[model samples]
Target: MDALLERIQSPAHLRQLSPASLQGLAVELRERLIETVSKTGGHFSSNLGTVELTIALHYVFNTPEDRLIWDVGHQTYAHKILTGRNLRMGSLRQQGGLSGFPRREESIYDAFGTAHSSTSISAALGMAVAAQLTGSQRKAVAIIGDGALTAGMAYEALNNAGASNCDVLVILNDNDMSISPPVGALNQYLAELMSGRFYAQAKKIGERVLRNAPPLFALARHIEQQTQTLIQSNTIFEKLGFTYTGPIDGHDVDGLVATLEKISKAKGPQFLHVVTRKGKGYEKAEIDPVTYHGPPKFNPSLGVVGAASSKVTFTHVFGQWLCDMAAKDPRVIGITPAMREGSGMVEFSQRFPNRYHDVGIAEQHAVTFAAGLACEGLKPVVAIYSTFLQRAYDQLIHDVALQNLPVVFALDRAGLVGADGPTHAGMFDIAFTRCIPNMSVACPADENECRQLLSSAYAQDHPVTVRYPRGAGAGVVVEKSLTPLPLGQAKIVREGEGLAILCFGPLLYEALKVAEPLNATVVNMRWAKPLDLKILQEIAQSHDRLVTLEDGTRMGGAGSAVLEALQDMGISRQVLIMGFEDQFTEHGDPGLLMQQYGLTASGIQQRIEALWPVAQVTSALRRVV
Candidate 1:
């Protein structure tokens, strides 16, 4: 069975296998995926679900020639394995290793690089149109999850694709899950489509009538088509001009292959709805798909064990703050674009279900919706990932900031996100948000500061975003009280001579580590937008040189704010701006990435030493004395 998998190098080889052999191959592929992901700690349940679908698609389609775009690309582990990357699975999501999501740079089979959701249909449609224009026989396919269908972008693409009359296949992989269990009317519509009695009966009647009638094969097919059209004429996909087919079993390899083969030969836009269990083959994943969705490296037999950590994550701090603040204020409402568990709002949703809204992967709508809530005198706290917030920039500027709505944005994952890579990194939020006219950006230093900043952001009248990193900060005790910190004030953590380090966000600790050795002063610049000019000027007057440290991009970031302020104040001091360079960060361990990018303590020290040597610092200290 293992040899069967090893022999197949690409989809070309996969196509060579007989239809009966594919079932065995799918099993082997699932086993290989589970084994690899168990050790690598990448996406789990989603990958398991797509094993058969991936195999069947690759087997049926002339891939590389025919484009296949996967929406939210996390379920491409099996796709990667089949696309000649099986041997490299050990290094999945590691530094310079295979990406957790589909990446065009990694393989030719990857039609489009996608970590974000609801993008596949648009990309696939573009490819399909291009192929049609070039007079190419190549087909385009977009395998989008049911969860992705919630976003308005998917519908926009569908509307266009249907009208274009191009030969494109859009397979809706309905697993009834997308990170958190999918919500909204779309999910309900899909469920209704799957279980509707009339449609099911009509399909059954067509199949039964067609059975044992080889002589009337053409007649039987026509009857089935007519029966399906009568029943499914009102379907959303059909209405959009797509020839909608199936609520078929996604795990049935032969069935999938047969359906795909038929669709491949047909013309015009096609929509195939395939129902799949999120964790089909693996029992542990199948039982609890959510926990296994993106688990850490775990023992396959024992499964993902919940080990309590002493350090409190910034997300937990925000969750706790949201709950506490909601308890105090009746106007408080929590909003997330389908990230309940990811944003640590699970407790808040449970406690205040009415006030909590998971808008389902629709970032633009989430922002505008929060703005509407704010207009109606409700304090809408949009708990969103910094990366996801980019999707709603127009909404943020027009709906929220332009109106100066008091919507508190709790931006989780505000820096290099490690394994998820550049596509998911929240490095540009500070830069982007600061430039927006009426928006305020807060960068918390630690766990306690994160809670305080959330409170502070909530208390503000205008739109404010409190940005924090992915995991736990420096284990500072988070205070229980909903005390708002003084807005836009910089806190002096340590006072020294010669040089001063203006640190933004959690990088304050890294600056502190190098402060003592370099005889430097450390100032925690809490707010990126409303810079504390008073404290900045004071620090500049006292120190010989200044350094601005942030976890975001160097261009137009928190450091840039400091520089612009200094220039306006006419303070001519030699300053070093430190942050992420103009490049997409790679997938790896966060600490290692920090070191590589010279964001760690030792790395900071080295960068500082290179600019102003130990001798220069000593001389400056002597002059100060």
Candidate 2:
């Protein structure tokens, strides 16, 4: 049979399909998603859960004109497939291929670019307001997951959205899970609301009797109101000024289509709660969604196979260090913003459940919460991604750094995170963190250094952050002992003449590669802040040319800090800075990105040869011959 999905080039075509045919299309879509993701290795469980919802949205709503915003767009693979990109499913997340998230440039249907969570409501509200002002009949809808609602921004938008007169439909796709199991009051409230028999009975009984008798319906409504008064007051959404609907089965395509058909015609702010199961169709994924949340390339029939590696990742080093530190120091505590597994804190969390805190998707709260713990004489270690840390910049500066609290931030995924792309990339941390007062930042070059730096940060009385890259470091033997490195120091890795490369973080390994070919000096500048002045000064004085290298952004990065130090010492040495360029980096293989950005050994060597005219001429002449 020719699949109905192939005919759905756009939402316009989707509107042509019969209601029963939409169900078959959904089956084909789910199978397509499972097969495509198994080969491509993209987001799995979330996409599976949103299959019917995505189909229903495009089928009922006039997309491209009527803006449909998806929060934390990992589940938009089905949306992409339905909206004319079905054939290109094979190239998902590849270089120059379709992005994992919704991009405004990619299609007219993608009204807004969204990779971060909790912004869909605000973006949709703005679009709704714009439509109202322009007198357009076009509607705006925000499809947000229950997990994304954990952040305060979602509520702030909800508070404003509920009060406004704009036309917008806020569909709450409740799967009872975010990336990690959702925590806090919101999850509890939704759980209570979903399971409460009083509300369920009232809804069922009130609607049945009202339809049966239109004349006595007004009196029946009064009785239903009396029954409601006996229970709790109106729902949280009702207070926020949104007309509430559902707790509907999201997998039921016909029900979803019918409900959305009505909501599309309604005016003002409307809220619809749809219940879904993560990894809905796939059996293995249904049993263990977390394992299937994001799996590597695998055979779908056999399920995801585990691949073993001997290399110890930097995240693993921090996780082990956290356990060791907690064991030695009774005051040691660990915290993650709903990323216990991703941050490599699963074992620590299992071992020390009391000492571990997972503050669900709230980075700002996590930072301030850590600050509160530090005030009471307990040492708190915040394990967060570098990109996510941007969300808590104000909290870090105001609550932690301002008070000089002894909070150790073990920043995992500190550089170019691979397939997840720019949205997940940890490019701006060095620039942002280094500027904060009373904040000390260290970048480790290897697994051994990562462990030592973590120990060093924990030893400090003030705020200290140990920033390391995503995966395993340069295959170095990490010692079991917990020893602190001297703060604000640099290690002279190699010695040569004429040229010097002062490298920061894991890029030191690449620097060593380039330095060996040129006989250039290499200094592993471990600390980004409190720049290793003594060693930098000596290198500047001796070497005819100096180069500063970092894996972070070129603008106001670690290399820029080195430039400021040289200027302070009144040195007029010729210097070249190398790092990520001004534009946002695209998603691809991490090694390919590094090579393209000129961070690899050969790339760095070529850049150095460009600076040294004699070497450049010799290289060019040799190539010609």
Candidate 3:
């Protein structure tokens, strides 16, 4: 056991320590975080960044009573360590263990359950409102990153908070890097040179003078306002109704603690702009936060490393296709909402610097920005996570789909993303994206298909989305040559006598397993939107039973599509739908989750076994009748 880990018994223990002792504790905590997280493989860089800030927040505020909401929640590891979760840190992100994100169920200190970005303000505002209504003397503090503030939702919350005049403290953790370092800092910096004590005192003196005097004081106040604006211009945040505070060094614990303590007593909505490095203490992560954002378990000394096999992932397939497509067509433009490394755009970005756009952590902006780019002759490809794309649904519909703009949306993590849990799962893209008019959705069965579909989406001038799951491909050799296949068509993987399994995306692999034993015909329904009716009708006429399977939500998924197709055709074939139930999946290993959901090869085979016996029994009953 680490001696440092033992010292962090509680936040109270943290409060008692002097500045020098706390600094030593921070180093110890950083070492413990590195050792455990390197083995457990949770979020690294952001947690490393927020160590001192977390310590200061606890030291300054009365937590459990005072609400503190972390924007992304991954950065709350240090907060968790301080708030009586130090022992459970080793089991971070594991099943039945500490969550990677903040969980209200786990501790009272975790005021809100969070994983998605830019939601802390809204949640914190709600907490403030609740406290006000209940007559609870609890202060609500929302710690948000400048990157998350780029999202329109954050501004919406700020507008509401300012109008309501709720006593909420919003700390903007600005590092000029909100996941990616390319997003430079914005806003004023008077608080940088002047101490918080001086600023507070000056504010009091100005208010007193303004109350007593008339003409000369009014003139002085106007001059002072102008001077302050020139020195520390009222940025967009202040205009929205927040009392803008800082661009302070977030790493300075004593400075942060003192500032927060002073501001905690203030009576209105306050915004503290504290800037810190992303991968603060660890040099490797500090230098390359984007790459080290969510690295797998590894030896910390060797630095973060990728898989040795160089197994071609679906993401890699997209990357190659993007670079190749951009090379061939100058009009093709690539855009990502600050996911350059994860979405596999590094090579393409390097190759076509002018054509590629990293639109910070603003999904809404990314969509509209791409839509504007599309108004010209440029074909914009917005690569984003399936879960994150949920944020841009309105933008996609209003800006792209309604206008019928040529925006190729590459939806990454288009299935059950393991370990990240319900908030991170790509379960609803099929249901949600399908609802938009003039929108085309495609899912690939393998790596080769993923490349070809992307090529197809780019070739089309209308709004098209191609979604692919995370992790490596099905080991299918992808071709360098790009070709657009006929739209609304499904391919048959095998032929059978009785049962037909219609599988979409990743479920194709498992469906094949069920098919191999039972000799069932399997159709890889590549397109999720335009249901492949020709094959569906053919199979309905031939097979007595049809099984539809997918990795997404069962509601309005590929199974539902097949059922709708058969219903529209008036061909009442006995169809069995299989996929995720209408429930949020918990965090676990991908394989474990798959098995739990009965979406695995053996699990599918067991279903086939039960159905095979039923088929025989039904045939015999027909003879008896």
Candidate 4:
């Protein structure tokens, strides 16, 4: 039985398996996924949920030719396994290995790359339209979750797709989740759509009754529509011109295979609503899906035993600051785009439920909504990931920054976020946010500074973004009080002659380590936007050479800002900027990525040695002595 799964090198091989063998293959696949993912620590519960759906899709469709687009891409582990990526599943999310999400370059089977949510419908529609233009018989299937369907983009795609007469099949994989639990009116609507017995009964009756009579087919459809309108309300998909079908059991492989087979041959934009449970096979995951959503490495037999560490993460610091901020300020409100837990807003959400807004998977809406709240004299704190914030760049600029709304963006994962890869990396935040006119970007050196900077940002009149890296900082003691740091000030951490190392964010630690050997002065430049010109002038006057260090991209980043400031002041000794290269950082251990990108102490030391040789420095010291 296990050998059957081994034979499935590709979807072509997958189609060869009998319907009876599929269930057995599915069992084997599930076991393999659990075994591999448990050690590799890839997306857990979502992948577990979609095992059957993935199998059914490949089994039914001529994938690679028939484009299959996965919305959000967390559930595509099974799809990857079926499409000749099973062998490399162990290296999932690792550097120089398979991406956690779908990548077009990675394989021909991956029709479109997807890391973000609500994009499958649009991508699938485009593929279908492209096929139509080329006169190809290929189909485009979009497997979107109810969670992704919450976004307005999905609806917009649905509207356009319905109007265009393209053959795009949208399979709603309703597991009632995104990263966190599904929320808002859309989830409720989906629940209603699933539970409505009248619609289901009427649909069955109409199909049976209409098949016998050719002339009364239109009348039968009319009757079905009337029944739906009266009982279940006119489905949004139906109104948008999709032939809707089923709250079908997604776990039932034979049923899914049969349904998908029929739907493949169907005309126009079709929507098949399939109900699924997150972590269907694994009991531990089923009991608590959120915890198992993206768990670290753990033994499957023993259950989730999280790595024991007393170290406080930057996320925890943000969560503490959020709770404290909400407690003191009566007008303070918290917001996240379906990232309550991820953004460290779970406690804030629990404590101040009224003030907390979880605008599900709608980053654009979340930003503008925060602006609206700010307009109403509410100090809205938008706790969001740096990667996710890219989606709301227009809203941040147009609605918030342009208006100079008093909003605080507590941007978590503001640098090379390990494991999630380049798509989820926060490398662009410093470059992106600093360029905006009314935006003030703060880079904290450590956890304590992170808290202080957050408080400082909240007090500001204009839109302020406080960006912090993922995971634990440099073991700095976090202060309990929310006293703000001096705005646009650089703190000289250590005074030394010859060279200056100007650091931004938590990369200050690495700079300090590199500076120790070089006897370079280390300055923690707190704010990225409002360059500390006074401190820069003093450092420029004192040091023969200056090195700017940051964890973001070198181009248009904090280092670039420093260079521009130095140019404006007409004080250029010799400047060397160090940060991420002009390329997407691959998925790997954060420390390894830092080393590879020349952000680590050893890497920085080598770069500095290249600029001013250690031998030359020693000779200069000897001559001076």
Model 3 Cα lDDT, one tens digit per residue, 214-241: 8878887788788776554566678888
State the lDDT of candidate 1 residue by residue for 7-106, as single tens digits. 9899999899988899999889999988999999989999999999999999999998999999879999999999999999999999989999999989
**On a 0 to 1 TM-score scale, where does candidate 4 land against the true structure?**
0.96
Q: Give the Å error, residue 349, model 1.
A: 0.9
Candidate 3 — which residues are off by over 4 angstroms? 2-4, 16-20, 184-226, 611-625
* Predicted model with the maximum lDDT: 1
Q: Give the TM-score of candidate 3.
A: 0.91
TM-score of each: 0.96, 0.97, 0.91, 0.96
Identify the runs in model 4 with alpha carbons over 4 angstroms from their true place: 213-222, 615-625
lDDT of 2 at 300: 91
lDDT of 2 by residue, 553-593 (tens): 98999988988887787777678899999989989889998
lDDT over C-alpha atoms for residue 266 of model 2: 90
- Model 2: lDDT of residue 546: 81
Go through the candidates in order and give the clash count of each.
Answer: 0, 0, 0, 0
**Which stretches of model 2 miss by more than 4 angstroms?**
197-205, 212-215, 229-232, 615-625
Candidate 1, poorest ten consecutive residues by summed lDDT: 616-625
The Cα local distance difference test for each model comes to 0.91, 0.89, 0.83, 0.89
- Candidate 1 Cα outliers beyond 4 Å, as residue runs: 197-233, 617-625
| Model with the higher TM-score, candidate 2 or 3 | 2
